[model samples]
Target: MHIPDGFLDAKTWITTTAAGAGAVAYSLRQAKLALEPKRVPLIALVGAFVFAAQMINFPIAGATSGHFLGGTMVSILFGPWIGALVMTAVLLVQAVVYQDGGITALGANVLCTGFIGCFVGYGSYMLGMKLFRGKGRAIVAWMSAWLSIVAASAGVAVLLAASGTFNLATALTAMVGWHMLIGIGEGMITMLVTGYLMERNAVMTGGGFKNERLSRNRA
Candidate 1:
């Protein structure tokens, strides 16, 4: 969900701004430390896709909108730090160029949608994978994506309540309720895309090894 300007009050935005900045800074370091050279292109591609997917959002509340957030998919394919960075970049561009989200509320949006979504979704997916002993990958991805959106909405709801936009219950009911429905469709999309990519990668990897062995035998 993208929060427009004026959605958050001064104190709330300021606090979230500092927190978001810190999160982005930390993410930069982590991503750099764990960066894989080949995955850079994939990161850019996923970032572009996420940016495009988020453009088609529907207004949910007074100032916010609901859309497909690619946090879970990114984290699953790459890592949480890269996912956070990708989301932050997407939010920054949308705020600056498109004005889809507000500059004033950028920090809150980043905190809620960028950092919170990635970390929560990634953690949930990892936990599911562990519990299932790495079985049901598609199911785990779908569930994690669904949970990520809901959790991100809950973060937005809390901020809305803090900003006095609405009381806690009202904000939660409105934001989380709308997003819960949105999450279902978005989650399925995330699942399908992630599963296809994973399956394709596996095939390509296996085929490469097989070809390499054949070449060596021929040589």
Candidate 2:
């Protein structure tokens, strides 16, 4: 949900810009500490994938379209800090090169889709994993992906209301309504891709079922 220029008022954009800047800075620091050298390439690849995925918007109801938001997927593989950074990079490139999102509204877009999406998705995934004792990881991932989209849509609605573009209740209803459908696509894609990638990695890293059983027997 990229906010075009003139959608957000000056005050709203300014406030969001400052907040986004601070959040990005903090996330950078955290990423520096948490990021591994081997993960750099993975992060870059995921960021590029997210950027490309966002370019293809599927039509929803009411002439609006929705694209995949990859915050949840990245956060599940990496962490929230790196996830936010990757999202911010995607937003920056989209705004600068493609002009998909407005330059003036860049901060609002980052706050809503980058930070909010990553944190909400990651937190929900963590909570779901805990509640299910990690047995239903695919289900948890799907739920996280779906919830992230809804949460980001709600953030955008709030910003639109704050900018006086529309009433808060109406904005919420419309944005959330369309996004609920969009989130299904997001959930399915996240579940499939994450499961595949994670499983492949487990096999490559000798953490698959056979390896694990062998190791346990040796112990």
Candidate 3:
């Protein structure tokens, strides 16, 4: 959900810009502390993939288009901090090189799509795993991905309402309604990609192969 220029008022954009910058800075620090050397290249690759994935927007109902938001996939494969970083990178590139999103509105987009999407999706996945005792990771991933989009849309709706672009009730309903369909696509793609990339045996064992390898290396 890229918010174009002029969508947000000065007050909203400025506040969100500062908050987004702060969040990204904090996430970078956390990523640096927890990041593994091997995962660095992987993060870069996934960031590129996310950038590419977001380029193609499929037409949805009401003449609106929706694209894949790779936050959940990245968070699941890596961690929330790195996932947020990756999403920030994707947003930056899209804003700068592609001009897909507005520069002034960059902070808002980052806050909604990068920060909120990653954390909510990651948190939901974690909660789902805990509740299921890790028995339905794919399902959890799907649901998390879907919910992340919906949550981000809700955030955007709130911002739109705050900006006086639309009333809160109307904005929330319209944004969430369109995004629910978008979330289905998001969930399916996340589930398929995560399933293909993750090892079945490791999934069944409630650990990832990459994590197991990392643990063994540490030992």
Candidate 4:
């Protein structure tokens, strides 16, 4: 859900911009510390994949479009900080080069789809893994991905409501409703991709990902 220009009021956009900027700044620091130099290529590959996935959107509510958000899967493979960076990069390219999303609303879009998506998705995945005692991994991944999409869509709805673009209830119903269906694809993709990556011992498997989990648990 890439919010377009003029959709959000100045106050709403400015507030979201500040919050989103702060999140990204923190993410950069955390990612630098957590990320391995060797995984840079993997990050680039995932970022490209996410950008391509977002490019193919299906119509939703006659107002917006829905697509697979790779945040959950990426976070599982690399961790939240790097996942956020990947999403931010994709959003920036789409906004500047393709004009797919508005520049003014970039911060808002990032807050909802990048920051919110990454953290919520990551958190949910971790929690699910914990709750299930590390069993039913595929199911956990699917549920986490689904929840992440719903949470991100809800964030977008709240921003729209604050902007007076639509009332809170209406915005929530419309955005979340359409997103629930889209989330199915999001869930399946996240489950299969994460499973494959882990099985193949790809990317952050033993290094960054394990460290990320350890740090998170200690926290």
Which candidate has the highest TM-score of all?
A: 3
Of candidates 4 and 1, the better by lDDT: 4
Candidate achieving higher TM-score, 2 or 4:
2
Q: Please, what is the whole-model Cα lDDT of each candidate in the order they appear?
A: 0.85, 0.87, 0.87, 0.85
Ten contiguous residues with the weakest lDDT in model 3: 198-207
Name the weakest run of 10 consecutive residues (lDDT summed) in model 1.
199-208
- TM-score attained by model 1: 0.87
Candidate 4 minimal-lDDT segment of 10 residues: 199-208
Task: Give TM-scores for every candidate, taking all chains together and pairing residue i with residue i.
Answer: 0.87, 0.89, 0.91, 0.88
Give the distance in Å from residue 178's predicted Cα in candidate 4 to where it truly belongs: 0.8
Clash list (residue pairs), candidate 4: none
For candidate 4, write residues 127-201 as lDDT tens digits: 888798678999999998998999999999999999987799999998889889889889988998888877532
For model 1, residues 97-154, the per-residue Cα lDDT tens digits are: 9887888899999988888899999999988976996689989999999999999999
> Between prediction 1 and prediction 3, which has the larger lDDT?
3
Which portions of model 2 miss their true places by more than 4 Å? 200-219
Model 3, residue 85: C-alpha shift (Å): 0.4
